[model samples]
Target: MRLRGVLLPAAVLSLTMLAALPLPSCIPQSTPPQPPPPAQPPPPLEVTNPILSGDFADPSVLRVGEDYWAAATSSEWAPHFPLLHSKDLLHWEVVGPIFQTAPTWSEGNYWAPELAQDKGRYFVFYTARQKGGPLCVAVATAAQPSGPYTDHGPLVCQELGSIDGALIRDENDTLYLVWKEDGNSRSLPTPIWAQPLSEDGTRLIGAPTQILMNDSPWEGQLVEGPHLIKRNGWFYMFYAGSACCGRDCNYAVGVARSRKLLGGWEKNPLNPIMKSNESWKCPGHGSVVTDTQGRDYFLYHAYRATDFVYVGRQGLLDEIQWAEDGWPTINGRRGPGGKVLAKPAAFSEDFTSSSLATGWVWPNGRQPTTSVEAGLLSLSPPADRAADPIGAVFARSTNAGNYTAETVLDVSGLPAGMAAGLSAFGDPENALGVYVRSGKVEVWHRERNTHEVLTSLDAPTSADGKLRLRMTAKDGQTYRFAVSPEDTTWTEVGPELSGAYLPPWDRGVRVALTAGGVAGASARFDSLRITPN
Candidate 1:
């Protein structure tokens, strides 16, 4: 083969000279081939839709350092305004509630909590109905996200009711409270308003000024859930419009921008920018939170279409992207949900602590009597609560349409009229359970305060009074109960039952450990676990 670069000095060299060229050691050689660096794996996906699995409506999230904390509406439940924490914004756990007891000044109907942090302190701006009065905006302060909050109740109780209180800071670092007037309750048009907040955020100072209203047709008599963020020399306000909940909810989100916090606000031509998608319905009422990377994500609530509103409005996360025209769009204007997501966090409790975890919840003010120690949990109803149908129940919300809730308990001590078991519960009036009492295992359901035993069977007797119970939910509305004798075997306790009547319009079904009976009766639980399908 002829070498392409060999000139040979334009003359043939003698063989002796070529062979004597220092045995080719003086010549350059091609670099030896090296294997390519091993291909790097792509970074794992770190976020998902329904960031929080169940009934976390009207989410307000805040970032501290690299961690995220969220708060949601409690409706009628107390220890109200459930607080959640996340490292990746994918898996979350309940840290506690905004209050360990409902505020004495507010009676029921807790909704739309907004979380914020300033300097070193954390603040929660929330909405609750005043006792014997209209719904009002309120504020609570805490040293930590999981807090013993101090309530500075009812900062704004307008005659028309005030709800959805959010905070914004002017360029001068002056704080303002932004909220919605609940005028739609009387068929009047609703308006979004802003007012100066005291430096400490305890009270409103200046008179409230109207920011935006239901001037557009799609707005349709209501415009609530106001959230504000400043960017590109403009203050952008995000708000939801129309009816907010229930089966016929027409919930949708819209945007407006202005030079200041109060006036000259103009709506985007593409109003109602975020609506329902195939995977979620009635997406609205969210707060925008910025991550450490300077990226913004909207933490909101939406109904999962597969389960309808039975699981309530679940917390969803969508990246908010800015268009070339300086307008923000959620999930690129395709709406919410339809994301490839890992399953939400699974809950398991072993009853190994002296004090119960903060995740357990009961009725708004009806505290359950419970004690945990030495790997066992004992629950009993208070003497005054005997008339309450649900008695003593400790519950946690489940995230999926189909899932299994199981608990191990000892029921040999239960009295003839007393019962204890695991339940799929909506409220005191709506629940399904498999309970044991006085040598009998029965599947019971409660509808409109009426109790019915779907099936009854001989109790599985054990030397130690140990029994296992399970409730499997299918297609979101059907349920089956099973019993076991502390082994691998589980026998069906009843025919498949319908759970269509469990959930009311505003609350999700929770997996509960319930005990209801005569005075002084109690139930002991060994452990509990929940697996979402």
Candidate 2:
């Protein structure tokens, strides 16, 4: 059937096929080009050791929701107990203090504060010296973490000296308080003791039981700073051992576990889980916490292994992990240094809003005559003549081992015997002050109640009646003092002073703007700056 041999044009054939096909509306189409996925943010930078760079010792931290709150020993420094707040474990800021004033019954030496919350009320368990009495554990209560806490007197220690009070609540909600016996006084073995606590955490309910003592060679003369935690149905007790102060401070942290809360305690085979290394000295007195992501962390204090031992113990952060055997171990296991850790989120603080930064503290209490105006800090001598110079000193903790502090002093209209300037103060008997006295600039050093003039120079004759004073703390070992007339050219005023004389028992040295003399003595400090070396 070569039947229809009729030739059709190519255009006609194409038109016929198109007309027979379905319409364009019925045809499927390719998807339009899509935008690229949004770019992800970079990870936060890692932080180094000593996350908190100042004298934050015996750290006890608590996690509440997204916030982490910490309390540290502020021995003889008032605002008695310092409270720090952080969103991440890396960064922290001072959020006032646990007590604006020391307890009336307690004279000085406020140490290790452990903070906890129950039924929405905050409680602080701390150690303080009673007026002319032995050091003992005490309790305080507040409505919030950053507190104006009210002291509830001392915990029952049965006439025994006690310190380093730590609190723990069991799964059954039973409360207990653990403390260290002050054995340093009697030259006996320091012991860890535990007692039941009342529901409100204000009173001791039962007889205290001694759980552990300084038995190991590593535990030198003391086994103190007890902290309790539970994991995998076991009670873990962490305690610090050895001397905690001075050049001989060989402190370390050890662990003990018990199936029962108050009995059958077993020390870890690998004792002294955290100890001093080449970079950090006397690493101990630590607290543990878990983050929102279920990561474990430990916070402790350590002194830099430099010639300058006067910087005191600064706060350190390290991550911890658990083994299959159920014991916890720090990630690096050595000590906090060299390793870069992930930083916590940033925090905001207004250091200039107040006359003193929130971090500033006085040795005993703030003087009534001290005032802050328009960024100027004014210090006036106490009206009481018998009061110690330590009380009148207005200072801030040195945040780093090596740093420089500078201030402009307006010493106009000063009386003959009055002096006002910068001071590296440890106590009434141990300090170095560079001041303008009797129309001359002099550097004085006080050692063991004897004050000696190191050097003296003519005061810079500035028409504005102001003197620029600067102190450089180098390597935490030596201090250099200088004076400037125009705040431009500085002249070395005194020989380099040895900072090693500053003992750790004095809790290192505080840089202060001091005014000392009879009544009506006042000094104005302006443009104070502290920079890390």
Candidate 3:
């Protein structure tokens, strides 16, 4: 066996002798690894067709068994406190306005409405204020889903300065109400309060206790619209704070949680769960619902098109996931630095009937029962609002860029002034309709509260009351109305509209065939459609 000799250099021996020198404790260390670029925002709801597209603001939703019901504020708009129902959450149909038999106080006071189901009865707790008026809460109840709910008087009487009253029931079956109020107007910030409800769940049984004070910059000057829920032994309150319209609007939803229902609640370390600026202005006033699968969702309203004449508040729904710490995040947007998830599904024409589509909505809560056969839809005239008309077949506007509305309608057997036409109705001064009036097919435009007859033709009228008409819209405010006896023979009766978009009092545009009091006369429609150019 050969033994190898170890050779040590003189410098190595001297360094070893210099001994083990210790480093200074004050020296800083290298930065910790960055948190994997916050897992990219989950994709937006892949909504090929969004259910709501016009002024469906401050929405509140409830999922009862397999059916989902929703309500929204309808400020200054007649047929107030509208309610909508859905089976898939993706396809929603208008059930009825909650306050069809609304009280005298309900006229100008349509605002945020919260819905709840107790026992077998449905309850709608809503708020409203007159023009330049004070806000108050009212309760309405109905046995069936679609309601002609009668008001149960004031939830909180006489006292003013309260809105957005949301209800929640604890595991112990104790009911509570959370709402916003300016209890201290000047010094302290606007806050949210909660109290136990009476055993009946119609009125408050205890005094309101302050649950949270606005402290977040995203909360702005006001903290309102409080909704509470319990999960995992913690009570979570979701609220929207700040104005939510136009350039100045900076609205967002914030949350706080506590182990106890009454105390020790903490403002979420992360807030402004949802927000938008400029392009998607005013994203606030949201509500959450749990689906049958136990998944959570956030239903909110946001402004898409700044064209006040064409667009206002629109409903947006996205999936929500809760953090391990118990705070919920919308579409997984992180604080003020998140993105809105796209809508969840595409609109399908599967449930469509020639007589009525899911998109149709009637003003003042009245819809005409119609006839559908062999691809032809016949609308019977409604008794009331005969001058204004009753039924409309509308789809949510989907003009991401250029907005165009083109449709084919046939007007035969139509009575005089009972027009076969197309119109867009939502905004104050945004209407462009083409129909047969006074025995002639004519095009009319209403811009920002003014009406104009643009063009007309001596179009043929049908003894059978059927006509084929098509109307096309472009930009934000231009339209062209065309008519035809059949799909092949099309004629232009109106010139390119310059300033028509949405007309006041018209809830939505559809193939309107209203009879102006001529008995045995009605209008027949072939096809109606809108295409954004």
Candidate 4:
């Protein structure tokens, strides 16, 4: 949908201007203009649920002074770990990533990053599976929250698998790292463990102690994504359990408390504190943070049950209050919804700047040839990388389930086999897109090794060789494609495409501009407009 300002007709404009001119003696003055309607208290800030509307999961947040910083799992989508910054808990902007490139030792499956600051240095502890190896927790250090973080090496590794690492500082200044011992494959219950860390926050100091394991009936087959916070002299560990992906995903967050940092823990009778409700499904993997005013909140992820599961898990936020009995409750025991919330302090991004907008990221990092200038983003397909899952793409998460994304592409320069257009990408195999190639525009969908062409139409001829493409996603389950020679009018190109085939393993669908083929092909895209419907 296009946004335009209302305009006045020529005759109406003339009369209105004349009426305002010399209303002097002609129109009797109204009785002194009555005090401006008491200023109507500027409509309450309507913050929306899922403050962050896209596939950002396993959020770990920390409040530093007045600023809040967060990091989340990128899995196989690179740029390593994603970092977000906000002045308030309600709104966030992407501040690039923690690692500019994947570590040499790890190939993919980077998940669950926890950000922490010790002494004065910032550290990020995360899980990465090395090529042909097991999943392990690793640490990286940077002077700033969003970093060119330097890998400090593995912090926790086991023969089976170890993932989801969280760091907490105790009252006595002791630092401890908590992580999960993955056991889903062996049919054994997954367990949480803790180990002390050195002063520099680089390595573990002693042997690990097992904290808790999957014991509740609702926990399904695993317990992971452990986050620890201290309240009222007690250590509270919040974790996610049950199946984390797919149509029947039963993921939920449960809490366990302990008097001692390492042992003597008891699960709350309430058990799963957060779970799926009518609107959002699989709500779990949460991290808690307190605002500047000391109000507490739970930041987590959940899927829109009505949308295709491949839409991924979007970021959600809910207010939490401590009960008289010292237990925490989320949104008065209600789940996520479309209800209006109070807006956080205002934040904005300038895409015209040389730096990429804080809301945009390149999945699996960016190719050296990818560059952004002014408002135009250009990408050159890498040579011999046709088989890469991520290919050459620059994407940003869909902040809402229903939205319209439009872009103007100059694909004239693309080689014969090269293609460029807008796409809803989950991975190389699972994507729905409308691409321009060889003087033709085609709509296609891919699932794993199968690629199907839904339709193709002749590319509209333009003097400048620019094509305008628009994609509308409804409830995140279906997509429609349209094209235009110019931005003003559009023609539907293909039938509505179903996204039902998208799988949860592909994570959430990233709306992106993609350029790829056999090497030497490049595409320039500009005027990208993403609007929520």
Best by lDDT: 1
lDDT values, one for every candidate:
0.84, 0.77, 0.61, 0.77
Answer with 1 or 3, whichever has the higher lDDT. 1
Expressed as tens digits, the lDDT of each residue in 197-304 for candidate 3 is 876667888787877877777777788877777788888887887766543556787788888766788887767777765446557787888877777777777666
| Ordered list by lDDT, greatest first | 1, 2, 4, 3
* Model 2 Cα shift for residue 61 (angstroms): 0.6
Worst 10 residues of 1 by lDDT: 7-16
Prediction 3 TM-score vs. true? 0.69
Worst 10 residues of 3 by lDDT: 503-512
Better of 1 and 4 by lDDT: 1
Q: What is the per-residue lDDT of model 2 for residues 1-533, given as tens digits with 9 covering 90 to 100?
A: 12289677888888888899877876887789999999774442355877776678888898988999999999877777788899987788888888887788888778888887778988888988888888889999988777778889899543558898888875567888888888766888788888889998888987888888889998888898888888888999888888887787888888899888778999887778888887788888888888887776788888877633577788888777678887777644676654532321221222345645687767675543677676566677567731333236777777665778888887666667677788888866678878887788889888887878789888979878788888888776679999997878899997899866765473877887777764666667766677776
Residue range 436-511, candidate 1, lDDT tens digits: 8667888989999898888999987776778999999986789999999965889999899998988877788888
Angstrom error of the Cα, residue 266, model 1: value is 1.2
The number of residue pairs in model 1 that clash at the backbone is: 0
Residue pairs in steric clash, candidate 4?
78-364, 79-365, 312-508
Candidate 2, residue 502: the lDDT equals 64
Q: Which ten residues in a row have the lowest lDDT in candidate 2?
A: 341-350
Clashing pairs in model 1?
Answer: none
Best by TM-score: 1
